[model samples]
Target chain A: MKFNLKKMLTTFILFFCSIAFLLPFVWMLSTSMKIEADVFKFPIEWIPSRWNFVSNYQEVWFGDHPFYLYYWNSIKVAVITTLLSVVVSALAAYGFSKVKFRASAWLFLIVLATYMVPPQASLVPQFILYRYIGLFDSHLGLILLGSFSVLGTFMLRQFFMGIHNDFIDAAKIDGAGHWRIFWKISLPIVKPAVATYAILRFIWTWNDYQNPLIFLRTDALYTIQLAMQKFTTINGSFYTLIMAAAVSAILPLLIVFILGQKHVIDGIALGGVKG
Target chain B: MPSNPSIETKTNIRKKQKNASKRRETIAGFLFVTPMLIGVSVIVLFPIVATFILAFADWKFVQSIDNLKWVGFQNFQGLWEDEKFIKSVINNAVFMLTVPTTMIISLVLAILIDKYTYFKSYFKVAFFMPYISSVVAIAVVWQVLFHPSQGPINQVLMSFGIENPPTWISDPNFALLSVMIIHIWISIGFNLIVYIAGLQSIPKELYEAADMDGANAWHKFSNITFPVISPTSFFLLITGIIATFKVFDLIAVLTQGGPLNSTTMLVWHLYDMAFLNLEIGYASAIAVVLFLIVFTITILQWISQKKWVNY
Candidate 1:
C-alpha cells in the first residue's frame, strides 16, 4: 500500500511538471490562433475566445519576407549538407575501420584531435578564407562549412568496427573491391546508425543560426532561423503574429522529432553506453 | 633439381601477387579518405592555424594580406584590460552553473520516470520538445512569456501577492538567470534521456541484492546508482561546459549582451568583436582563450575522472 501510494505521488508530481514544461509550446500554439485583443486577457485564456488562425498564418507565410523562400533555402542547405556529410563521413569511417593501411590509425587520430578545436576559434579565418576564395555569401560556402564532421566520422567508425571481418574478407575473395564491399556488404548493416546520423545532421543544419547568420549576406538566401528572427523583430508588437512565426519556425523540427524519436533516443543511449 | 626450381618460382609469383594486392588495398584506403581529408584540412585544420596566427596580428579582413601587422601579445593585453571581455568570461562561468542544476533535476526526474512513471515515452517526448526546437523560436516565445507586467509568469507571481516580479530578460540583474532557466529547461530532456539510459545499464542483480540486504533506497542510490552514473554525469558535464561557452544564439536572439552586459557570454563577445566591431585580431584572441579554456577543462576532467567515474 505504501509503495503504491509513493508511485502515485511521484506520478502526480511528474504530471504537473510535464504540463509546466510544455506550457511554452502550448501557449505558443494557442496564442498563434488568438486575436490580438484576446492575447492579454488576464486569468489567461488557455483557449482563445476569438480565433484568427487563418489570417495569422497567412500573414506569416506570405508577409513582406515570404517564409516559403526561407523554408526552401533551409531545406536545400540542410539536405545537401546532410547528404554530403554522411557520404563523406561514412566513406572515411569505412576506410579507417575496415581497410588495412600502414598509417590509418595515425590519420584517424589526427582527425579526432581536430574535433577538439572549437568552431568559434576558426570563424574569423573562415570568413576571410571564404572571401578570398570567392565563396563568401553563398550557400555553397555554408554547406561546405558543415560538410565534413570529424565527430561523425569517428562515431560511424565505431559502428563500422563492429562489422565482422569475415564479411569483408569473403567479399574480397570473390574479387570484390573495397568500394564494392563498402557499398554492398558493410553500409547496409550500419544503415540504422547512418540514418540516425542523417536525421541529426539535418536537424542541426536546419536549426543552425551562426553559420547562416555569418555566411549568407543576401536576404533571399536566408534560412528559416534568420528569417524567423527578422519576422519576430518586425512583428514584435503583435504577439499573435510573433507567436505564429515562432510556431512555423519549429513545426518542421517537431515533425522530425515525432518521426525519429526512437532513433534519437537510441543515439543518446549509444553515447551513454560508449561513455 | 628441375622440380625444385619450378616450385621456387611458383612460390615467388604468389608472394609478388600478395604484395601487389596489399598495395592495391592501401591505395584504395587512401582514396576513400581523400575527400574528408581535403575537407577537414581546408575547412577546420587550416582555419585553426590561421586563427592562431591572426591572434597575434592586426588586420581587418577588408585589408589586403600585405596590410597585416604583427603585434606580439598586444591583443592578449587588450583582452586583459577589456571590461566587456572580463565580464563575459565571468558571465560564462556563472552560466556554467546551469549544467549541474539541470543535471540534478533531470536525474531525479529520470529516476522517477524510469522506475515509477507509467507513460515513459509520453514524458520523454514532452521534455525533449524544447531541445529540438529552434533557438530563435524558443527565445521569441520566452520573450513574450517574460514580458514585464502582462506575461503569464509575472501574472502568476502578482496573483500570489508579490507586487513586483523582476522583469526577466530586461533587467540586467536577472537576464543571465532568465537565460539560464531557459537553458535548463531545454537541457532537461536530453539529460533526462541520457540519465535514464545510464540508469537502465545498472545491473538488476545489484538492486535485488540490496533489497535482500534490507538496504534503504537512499543507501542503495548512494552506494550504487550515483557511482555507476558518474560517467554519464562526467560526459554531460564536459559537453555542457563546452556548450555554455558556445552559447551565442540565445544571447543573439534574446538579450544581445543586454542592458548592462550581464549576459555577454564568450561566443557572443567574440561575435560582437569580430563582426560588429570589426576587431578581428581581438576576436581571434578571444577565440584562442575560448579554445584554451575548453582544452583545460577537458584535460582537468580526464585527470579527475579517476577519482569519481566508475567505468
Candidate 2:
C-alpha cells in the first residue's frame, strides 16, 4: 500500500508538471483557434467558444507575408543543406577513420579545433566575404553557410571509427577500393548514426534563424523564421493572427518530432553515451 | 635452401604492387576529404582568421578592402568604456545561471520519471517539444503570455490578490528575468532527457547495494546517482554555457535587446554593432571578447570537472 501510494504520488506530480510544460503549446493551439475578443477572455478558455480557425489560418497563410513561399524557401534550403552536409561529413568521416594516411590525424585535429570556435565569432568576415564573392543575399549563400559543419564531421567520424578494420581489409582483399568500401561496407554499418545526424542536421537547418537573418536581405527570399518574425512584428496587436502564425511555423517540427521520435531519442542517447 | 631468381623477382614485384596500392589509398583518402577541407577553409577557418585581424581595423561592409584602416587597439580600448558592452557581458553572466538551475530541475524530474513514472516516453516527448520548436515561434507565443494586461501568466498572478504585477518583457528590471524564464523553460526538456539517459547508465548494482544497506532515497542519490552522473553534468554544463553566449534568436524575436537594452547578450550586442551601426571593427572586437570568454569558461569548467566528476 505504501509503495502504491508513493508511485501514485510521483505519477501525479510528474503528470501535473507535464501539463504545465505543455501548457504554452496547448495555449498556442487554443488561442490560434479563438476569435480576437475571445483570445484575452478571463478565466482562461482552454477550448475556444467562438472558433475563428479557418479565417485566422487563412489570414496567416494566404494574407500578407504569405507563409507558403517562406515554407517553400525553408524546405528548399534545409533539404539541400542537410543532404550536402551529410554527404560531405560522411565522406570526410570515412576518410579520417577508415583510410590511413600520414596527414590524416593532423588534418582532423584542425577540423575539430574549428568546432570550438563559435559561428557567432566569425559573422562579419563571412558577411564581407559573401558580398565580395557576389553571393550575398542569396539562398545559395545561406545554403553554403550551413553546408559544412565541423561538428557533423567530428560526430560522424566517431561512429565511423567503430567499424572494424577487418571489414576494410576484407573489402580490399576482394579488390574493392576505398570509395567502394566507404559506400558499400563502412557507410552501411553506420547508417543509423548517419540517419540520426541527418535528422539533427535537417532540424537544425530548418530551425535556423541566424544564418537566414544575416545572409538574406530580400523579403522575397525570406525563410519561415524570417517570415515569422516579420509577421509577428507587423501584427503585434492581433493576438489570434500571431498565434496562428506561430502554430503554422511550429507544426512541421511537431510532425517531424512525431515521425522521428525514436531516431531523435537515439541521437540524444548517442550524445550522452559519447560523453 | 637455394636462392631462386624467379622467386626473388616475384617477391620484388609484390612489394612494388603493395607500395603502389598504398599510394593509391593515400590519394583516394585526400580526394574524399577535399570537399570538406575546402568548405571548412573558406567558410569557417578563413573567417576566423579574418575576425581576429579585423578587430584592429575599421571597415564597413560596403567599403572596399583598400579603404580598411588600422585602428590598433582602439576597438578593444573602446570596449572598456562601452556601457552597452559592459551591460551585455553582465546580462550574459546573469543568463549563465539558467544552466545550473535547468540542470537541477531536470535532474529531479528525471529521477522521478526514471524511477517512478509509468508513461516514460510520453513525458520525454512533452518536455522536449519546446526544445525542438523554432525559437521564433516559441518566442512569439511567449510574447503573448508575457502580455502585461491580458496574458495568462499575469492574470493568474492578479487573481491571487496582487494589485500590481510587474510587466514582464517590457519592464527593464524584469525583462532579463522574463527572457531567462523562457530560456529555462525551453532548456529543461533537453536537460531532462539527457539526465534520464545519464540516470539509466548508472549501474543497477550500486542502487541494489544501497538498498541492501538500508540507505534512504536522498542517501542513495547523493552518494551514487549524483557522483555517477557527474560526467553527464559536466558535458551539459560545458555545452549549456557555450549555448548561453550564442543566445540571439530569442532576443531578436522577442525583445531585440530592448526596454533599455536590459536583455542584450554578447551575440546580440555584436550583431547590433556589425549589422545595425555598420561598425565591423568594433563588432569583431566584441566577437573576439566573446570567443575569449567562451574559451576561458570552457577551460575553467574542464579543469574544475576533475574535482567533482567521476570517470
Q: What tens-digit string does per-residue lDDT give for candidate 1 at B237-307?
A: 88888888888898999999997998998899999999998888989999999999988887798798888
Question: Candidate 2 has which clashing residue pairs, if any?
Answer: none
Query: Which parts of model 1 are misplaced by more than 4 Å?
Result: A1-9, B1-8
Q: Give one digit per residue, the lDDT tens place, for model 2 in B4-65.
A: 98889899999999899889979998998889999999998999899999999998877777
Where is model 2 chain A poorest over a 10-residue stretch in terms of lDDT? A266-275
Docking band of candidate 2: medium
Candidate 2 — which residues are off by over 4 angstroms? B1-11, B301-308
Candidate 1's error at B244, in angstroms?
Answer: 0.7
Docking class of 1: medium
